[model samples]
Target: MRALAAAALAGVLVAALPATAALAADPKPDIAVTSAADKANYAEGETFTITVTVKNKSSVDAKRVHYTGGDSEGVDDVVYGELSTGFDLAAGATKTVQLTGKTNHVAWQRGYGYVAFELAADNGEANDADNITSVRLMVAGAFDDLGGYVFQGESYDAGWTPQTPGVEGVKVVATSADGKTKYAEATTDARGLFRLAQLPAGEVLLTFTAPAGWKILAGENGEYDHTPALVIADDSDEPQIYVPAKKVPVSSPSASPSASPSASSVAPSASPSAGPGLPVTGDNTMLFAVAGAVAVAAGIALALVARRRRVHLQA
Candidate 1:
């Protein structure tokens, strides 16, 4: 009877040991989506790859594993790809599956969006049988194109020095002709190159700000000052700004011989007399004396002519 009890005990212990071992084994699915062949961002009509990795966590080998692309959470009506064939993933083993897809959607707003993925067993499409791992894909648009312009003079030249080299800053502001609407703005780097972007095609007022210890010199017209104005058209080329050197005071040249003497310096001297001993007559008296002399000479000539004529007639 004791022997029978021992055999029965041995059988019960063996059954309990198998049950304990099964309970200790891991139960979670080992499948994972490793990485997307293409990074988050994609251009239109670009082909990209999505890789799904499957690992069997259970003691029993998974005969077949399958995956499917699902709706992107935040993206509206975004499509992924046709699900691939089911492949065998052995126990405690991993396999990477590749899926090809194209981006048909475009014009995403200027923010973050994600692409999602769903995985499952080949036999069932329900959530209970499906081991789902989502790979988050970000979608973004391209950066805006900044138009080009030039810089010159002390701020840009090699010989020029700034009072506070590193601390000083310069920027270009573009606005409408009325200066009411701001279109674009760019800050100058140490090299003094500022690129303006996202500007509409029109007459843009390009203004510059001088760094510390520097000033912006305005040209004859306010538009083209130390910094020239840029008229950007749809087809216009990049603007070239020629900032002239600071105006240094130039000394005036000496007066020429032809130039009249300054009125402030010397008084006018009296003219010399026509006769050596007589003082020079005033302009009015000189005119009257000349007229009297001319009259007396004319009368004497007339008398002499008449006397000669009478003598001839008497003879």
Candidate 2:
């Protein structure tokens, strides 16, 4: 009776193992970022700091988690901060991250910039909507932008023809008229649009740097008083010199026949000639053996002669 009772208890425990594992396999961690600015107002180009509070609201621990946030316009655009570098957060726990940023030179007439951020985790989440947050700051004054679009162009004897496709990743820079001081710089995006804000009031030179394998047809370098009005049109903008794409040369097949002869074309002669004009018949094994020996001797002699020539050349 004792052995039978022990077996029944063991069977019950075994049956419960699957349920326990199924419960353990289900992971739910909700990550969220509660963002706030350190101050309400910042002067144009004044550096400021913000805090982002990261929270895991679920009962389960969140693992391999990270957070992403930056200035409203772009990362480090008006504000910058250190993002979470993948960490584990205990159940219902929260961690705060800090970021530093400079207020943009160009802002609304009333002066306002936004800081945005989001949170994520490797473990599945219960809800994703609450993971993002943003904060606004008042920045005084407005600034001009050095911005424009770059396009593809084709060159002809008369002039250049502009195309609709925009060139991306062109480095645009704003500098003083003498090319000494650099005010702001930015790279063109997919739409070939670039903007450099925080530009001081003065004459500036705009230089465009093309990516690898691409040439700056026009607007390589130019002077501007105000934000120069540049369009894809030639008359409206500077002369855009476009070089056509190079043509690939085609190869033609050679006229010579194949160097190697086919096996079917190679065949044994009908009569076996043992010597010059000497055809042998059956039972010529001895004759063939003698001929093979002579041929081997001639080969050894030729090899020795070649070796001797090599030695002489070395000497």
Candidate 3:
């Protein structure tokens, strides 16, 4: 009877062990937003597509997984996608959804925009923070505003040290390559700062109207019609304009003929007088002048729109 009773107890304990292990296992599934991305840059009013990926990390399947896209900055708004549809995501599987969006006119104001994506599962996720992702986009078009400073100096160094002072009252105009379409124009302020707004994005010539006897030095990189070819793109970096300094005349008393040395005896003045204009050294000589002036006048302030995200709790 003792042997039979001990065998019965062992059988009951073995049956209860399976039930206890099942109760200790995790019940909730783990869903994560793996990625969200779009084109790095877009033209204003252009239609762009965004792709968001969702994954189920847990061994248990996730039911009715849904995603949503939103523009926190209001610059780019998602127009159409499977925003409301929900579908099952198998365990350790990923789903990628494609969405379409349009860039607003004001997108170029901030130079960039952002879109956010979030995921939710019916079974809930172990980590809610992993359900959110965002993408950044740079906007470029006619809605952009282009501004810079014009200085009377040689090319600046990589560290952006201006070799000369600002040239005041210089007229800077943005025109087509053929000079047929005049998009925008502005006169440099006392500090040689000029701003051209609402200029179309593309290759445009920057022609300068300077004071008499002053020369407009062509930029170092691209030259269009003897002027700088300013490509209005994402505006990641502002362009520079350097005006040749005006030459000042130096007067001297006439020397007697006896004091004058023969042409061969006269060594070129160790220091020659200033010329009417500076020679074009290279394409990159004046690249830093405008950027340097802008840094000194007012600090460059670029505010990138931040990505916004939220978690949706599902039953």
User: Which candidate should be chosen as best, given TM-score against the real structure?
Assistant: 3
Model 2 bad stretches (over 4 Å): 1-25, 68-71, 74-82, 108-110, 142-315
Task: Locate the minimum summed-lDDT window of 10 residues in model 2.
Answer: 225-234
What are the lDDT figures for the candidates, one per model?
0.52, 0.62, 0.65
lDDT of 2: 0.62
Best-performing candidate as measured by lDDT = 3
- Candidate 1 lDDT tens digits, 10-98: 99999999899886663534454444545756554455566766666655555456655555432443333333556766657877666
Give Cα distance to truth, residue 146, candidate 3, Å. Answer: 11
TM-score of each: 0.31, 0.36, 0.39
Q: Which scores better on TM-score, 1 or 2?
A: 2
List ranges where model 1 is wrong by over 4 Å. 1-29, 73-83, 110-113, 122-130, 136-315
For candidate 1, the TM-score is 0.31
Q: Please provide, for model 2 over 1-315, each residue's C-alpha lDDT reduced to its tens digit, 9 standing for 90 to 100.
A: 999999999999999999999988887999877878787767766677788788889998988677655337422444233365677888899888777776654433324666676767777777879988887776544445545666554431113233456668878777766778877888777766676666643345667776765555443232221222211111222222222211124456578876786665554355665444434344566788899999999999999999999999999
Worst 10 residues of 3 by lDDT: 303-312
lDDT of 1: 0.52
Task: Please give the TM-score that candidate 2 achieves against the real structure.
Answer: 0.36
